[model samples]
Target: MKFKISTGACFIFFSGLYSNLLLPAMELQAQNINIPIVSQHNALVLQVDGNKNLSTIYFGKKLLDQAEYNNIPELYKQGTDYTGILNAAYTPSGSRNLLEPAITVTHADGNNSLDLRYVSHTITQVNDDVSLFSVVLKDPVYNFLVTLYYKSYFREDVLEQWSVIENKEKGAVILQKFASANLYLKAGSYWLNQYHGDWAKEMQPEESRLTHGIKTLDSKLGTRTNLFQPSVFMISLDKPASEDEGTVLYGALEYSGNFRTDLELDYQNNLKIISGINNYSSAYTLKPNEVFTTPAFLYTLSFTGKGNASRKLHQWARNYQLLAGKGNRLTLLNNWESTYFDFNENKLAALLKDTKKLGVDMFLLDDGWFANKYPRNDDHAGLGDWQENKQKLPNGIASLVKEANNNGVKFGIWLEPEMVNPKSELYEKHPDWVIKQPGREEYYFRNQLVLDVSNPQVQEFIYGTIDGLLTKNPDLAYIKWDCNAVIYNAYSAHLKNQSHFYIEYMRGLYKVLESIRAKYPKVPMMLCSGGGGRVDYAALQYFTEFWPSDNTDPLERIFIQWEYSYFYPAITSSNHVTDWGKQSLKFRTDVAMMGKLGFDIVVSRLSDHDLQFCKEAIKTYNAIKPKIWQGDQYRLSDPRAGSIASVLYVNEDQSSAVIFNYLVNNRYNEGSKMPVLLKGLDPVKKYTIKEVNLYPGTVSTIDALKVYSGDFLMKAGFNPDVNAERPSVVLEVNEVH
Candidate 1:
């Protein structure tokens, strides 16, 4: 049942279902409470609990925060209560239960749950940092934590990010902010990590807030996902550092999540986990009719140095809330190489054998697996044909799906339904179905033509093709939907005019996606352009992940990805470890872990020593992936400023943090010092720091690690003979809180 906690000045409301119930007291002193409310109405708090707290659900009505769109007020609440209820029956306009706006609460001691739905909960924000609401339920469940944060209306311009201090010994503040506009600044070692794939920051020449860009053979245009505001939300886990030191900051904007059908846009479910210096925040989800109960420890900071500590913390968290917040974890390894050329079953099976052993969870088939004569090796050959290449695989698509499943790995496929090739049977049979200028020469990229999804016939065909594939093979787990070419000679036969085709085409694509998702809700999909070509926020509503770039070089990625992280979630970006590099295995492996760690290089190519190292790297990554993807990201150094150092660390559950430090330059000089102080960790916990790959034998005791209010000395200096280009060190510390 829904529960509301009010203390005259502070109000808390929760909704969701769970089996356990514990009416805990508001145990905090009055001075420690502050609620960040997004609106005056619909500000109720809700929570959901399940067995062992597998997921904690938090939900509430959020008002959209928009400064650019003129129709903000109109769009704010227009659909907040819209239950997709239409003319189902005749009823008075003022009084109708068609919507059934109610909060549901489910509880189970361990396995059995009682669900309670409450339709009446009036919510109001009493002040800027406090809100009050009330809910009535027949029974209540306890032992669940409740919290109230912003769940604002969707905005296209901005993104939110939450960063914690990486120091294992010292308590540091955590920073969160909603970024505004795309402009970036040379802040301290703070950098934002984002999951945006191959899209540029600059607007396309003809691209507007709505349209303009070339369409790919898959009819996937780069112009659709552009952000309304290039701004980012930021939070500081410690005292702010000087903007000058080229301290790169990492942040990301990911577009993949669980979406509900009733809401045209994905149901907004973005939040940040803020933890105090001594405690770590638990991962939770919000359920209906339950209260969002969160302990204060989830959002605390440690101060190593006393320099405007609380101010920094508030600034950080508030900034993240201001920007639209979303996140993702796990970088993926795709099989574009294995399937791109229409390899046979044996070829794929062989390729997957090595990939699975390399610690990769996902194996994505990139094109070429579908169709017979119209092999998808190139864009112009296979557009509308989503059939399997039987000649290459006598066992059919199910065999490959089953084979991958048996190997303990998830299998994914690629498809580009938005376009067609003139030579293909689909386009030849329906010449009027393509989107192009009537008289002008049809644009062809890799011999492909963009499909006019605006046509109901085309949408139906696309849907049927996908439906058939899923029905035929239930083992399909992932898809790498790629858009290879750009829209040239753009026009839609179904549109009233060419001027409206761009937006209309996008809308049609969304419609097709909506239909597809209605049937297949569990499959994960990734958006890929030529490479970071169509990166933006719009596509995020539909897709779960994105490819950062086609370039797999480690050193190059340090910069390429460093730039992209400013407004995306680090988890959505796939980092592939490839042998395409001439650098040392250490450098490459280290760089790969910076993003969602994956392998693209031939694993067999590495030496015995390298192989062992690779295996160890995988183990290390798995142990720390949660922290890297979820903890606050900070850029300790930048190559642009001639400082070849970059560091990212995740708190070690209030005990310590694992740090990946890329020393671009040699720092092997005897007694060379790189005195670094960490933040966002527990000072109360005992910690031991060691450079796992650097000083393998040395360990330092951390006694309440202090935040660096000023410059700190390095532990080591540059090596006398620097390689000029290689990642040097990786640090892993253990906290004993």
Candidate 2:
């Protein structure tokens, strides 16, 4: 192996075997080897020492000149006790470092101490705004190699990193832990912000101060990894982090399976973050010449505050991470919450008629539509059997699609392809397909067993389940893919080593998704893992949007949507108006309009007054849908801290904007007025404000005929009425040409 070092006006190449002997003599030359991975507003500089170990020198705002790299001081300690505190770019399990290791391996000779040193590096400019960098590291005494890859989206100020490990030894080695990226930050007071909740209450924000210890945020549930999302914001505590001011660093792991993120504030006060797949009961064995790759870890730094960090991620996701991201999301009406499993073909047709009358873009026949020997009247009977229930449907899914088209709307169906019920024919025929441990009883969640997707046959079955549905009904317009169970037994019968189940399952799922995407490229699919359980970037790559939660009560959703917008874009969050609570129809409609608008309520049951409100709200939402879908979002007030929640969306050109304010709760003796400051608008432009979606007798706080300058509106925010009778407002702002 050879390594290349580029210094000022000179380049030196050396063989790997002779590096140790020649390094001492050329210490000055080696110290000058700096590789700076730069994005539009941030830079991560890696330096190679005389010992060939890689260390991070700087990671913050962009440095304009190469000389700035040399001016950055490296942290040092003179005593042996503090030697392990040095921030090695990527450390292995060894005595040299006492902190958490990025990769831990036990060799064939029973030696677990392994040291990794820099070998070679390469940089490739994929485009004007994207660059890829890779560094090779290897153990001095073993034939184990790990290659770290970094990709930078310059325009978005986002960076992604992952690692690939290969073993060439004669015997197998046990991989105890493998992390995708290891990031180091200089000494500072820090605050860690994370999202955590369960089931219908997902994405609740929790912030805490970082102290002198290790903080681990992880998800142990194999499938439903959203018990706690693998993402966080580390805010520098010069002061409290707000929307527009303070330094913030954001990180998210792109894995739908079990994940772990570690934030360690070392004894020396510096911080180190290790993030990747969780290593609980998942010690993988890499055989000779075999390789394993980890999921990508994405991160970005924002000096302007947490809001800018969120925008950076949203910009990157819309442009590269999302499927059909540039396309418009449809406004759908679903039947699950309305009728559950009690609806037949005629009932669905009637719903489709109402859906058309309300001007909904599509009618989604969710769940209960597919079954055979065992009817799916409830969640207990039919899951893997993906055929239409003959008694209920009479004709088939094709007939429903035709009915939907005849009603002047599109058709969609819900499917849970990754689960099996014991009473179903598929599970009876192939009992071995379900994940279970031999000679042990299996546990079930939601009356379903997770399919062993790691098996090739299961992968093909999943793909066929989707392909057959779309192929048979060519006019089907959408799909709501859902998973409702977590791995209980956590065993794959087909794999000789059961520890690889989680990673293999994710690989199999992506393979199936890739195949379906290749065949039906235009069909929009929504990811619903029992509602927001599998909300991660890995799944979002193939899905158009995701149901943020099953709890659609507008009051609860105000807090949920506020927390969700911290990292995810509105276009990818599916919000629905359901008959779950007593909130007014207008209030529910206004809340749902903040995201991909949809309805999950029985339209025929609504009062005439409510029906008209729905019609007007949908029309108003469609008028400003373009700006809401592709725009910058500003969160004005946090719902968790108070009774009022406010959000604003501004178009790229600042020509149009929308503001939503909700009085989540009302208390006696409190004022019925809330101030909402607008953001992301052109300060010099004159704009007109209109209160939309109002009932015939309802009153609004805004004077629709009055015009205001952007400067005045932002400086002196307008107040909206927040009484018990009318608790929400949706204001439209357009530049006065």
Candidate 3:
């Protein structure tokens, strides 16, 4: 029997939608909501319960039977319907639904949720290859309107989801909990793979078997800290997952602030996943006519394996989502590790002289350039005061920028506009602009305080300050925006509504970035938060490459870059080489060439031989960037937990290829020679391979091996002796016509 929720509750017999299936419980009349599932060639599919509360069904593969919906009531009773078309039970919310309370509000003077029922849905064409679906639901008792958005596009077998919550009630309603997207998958033995690490050591790929409960990863320290990240993968691991053969479901929240990613399994073995912004310390209060929009949650499923899943993300990032906008071939040098907080007009001129010799594209002038009331010789002072320090750079920024441009290198400067120092003039003027709990001891990180971007005044200050600097220096071609502190007590003295801190803060930050981007549309900038802290899709809208990690230890970087490549293309990563008294320059040069090549070593200090070598390396990076940044990257060997690590990049047409190989333990590890099987190539084509070993200590050379067909090379593999001193080699291969 079907029932309808009229002003006067009544029941009606209906046998149209559910195939005339009989049910024991009083069921709601199935609305004529025809949710269309677009699955071509059985690559991927989506099924929605438009008949009820817009619930999601199998979305990955055509693995379920249609008859399963005939007896939803039986499934509901057996605890299998954690994703019940409209689950309102405690058991469902507790263990099955990833979000604790999909809907929470204080409407009747306390925490209560009125029954939310289905309303309607719509599909709109976005472009030639993309479409959007919006499902509307309403809670009559509380009068809340919830709209769920799902966007599907061609290629990569991907979809994006988010939610919008509006207060349709007469009075204000406190939204205690909300989630962007949730998914339910049939029972299976699944394994979870995720990215985790610390500051300057981000993107450590890890995998572990999923037990029979909730597995969660979150960032509560605000600013999407490196601890618990926003990127993760849940793949069906009947056996071990490989590069090209397994069911892998990858997901990431396009948010830069506090976020949560969870994978939960119910007792019935059904799996549920929820990902969105973290509503940890505050619940947004929505006034009448007010609405809250969550950041986009991107996900994709691949049956061919985890590699294809990663390649899909990489393709999207480079083709559509990159902040660079397109085809940017920029090589640069950053004066941070070499000079730190010390520099002058003369010092910078010398660096620019060296920059031009190497054919470098840009010269990035890092921190300590701006300080009006306080000396920013160290990290403790001069953050908010954006004026140039006359004592350090006697020539104003415009003058310095002109000098760099005269030398053929575009000049860029660093700014921490969203932060303030207690010893700076800006903080002295408006201490209230910083975020701090009233009467609290007030915590500080990196001797700096985070600005309360939620406050309109602070937002304007950040925008105006950076705007002034760029306007003063039109020759400036780049900006390195660095955020060095985690948010705490994100309180705004100007706003009485404390719950809106996260949302408002991010909004303000975006407003400032967007304003700058509008003014300087052609300049390329990097997003850095003490290194690799704010590298997400949300921030990618405004910034170009992101500094992956501060620990440019090339050995450690090999693992870090590999993990990051799973979701992002090399174009969005800026890598640098350091002559850190320990590692050989050759080893570091080869590592830096793997991504956006940057230099941190003092130029004038380098020996004549070392400088010439660097010049040659930069030339190589310049020639190969277009392919490396836009090509299909394949992990030739595991960087972590393996004896040999390698990466391969092949152009879309398979006309060119670049490969890098690193030996884990040349002298001590089990393998004396590393054998690597190249992948993602035209197997029938013959190829000419050339070797360039940066490390002079390496004994084995690429010239020792003979070129063969891609098929033979992939099958027979190539072996390189693990030189006792340096064990890294870089190879360039071209298709031989």
Q: lDDT winner among the candidates? A: 2
Which portions of model 2 miss their true places by more than 4 Å?
1-30, 74-81, 228-239, 669-674
Q: Locate the minimum summed-lDDT window of 10 residues in model 3.
A: 2-11
TM-scores across all candidates?
0.58, 0.94, 0.89
Candidate with better TM-score, 1 vs 2: 2
TM-score of 3: 0.89
TM-score of 1: 0.58
lDDT (tens digit, per residue) of candidate 1 on 134-158: 3322212332222222222222111
Q: Between prediction 1 and prediction 3, which has the larger lDDT?
A: 3
- The numbered model that scores best in TM-score is 2
lDDT of 2 by residue, 629-694 (tens): 789888876676677787888999998899887877678634335566778888899999888889
CA lDDT, candidate 2, residue 452: 92
**Candidate 2 colliding pairs:** none
RMSD of each: 17.2, 5.2, 7.0
TM-score of model 2 vs. true structure: 0.94
lDDT of 1: 0.44
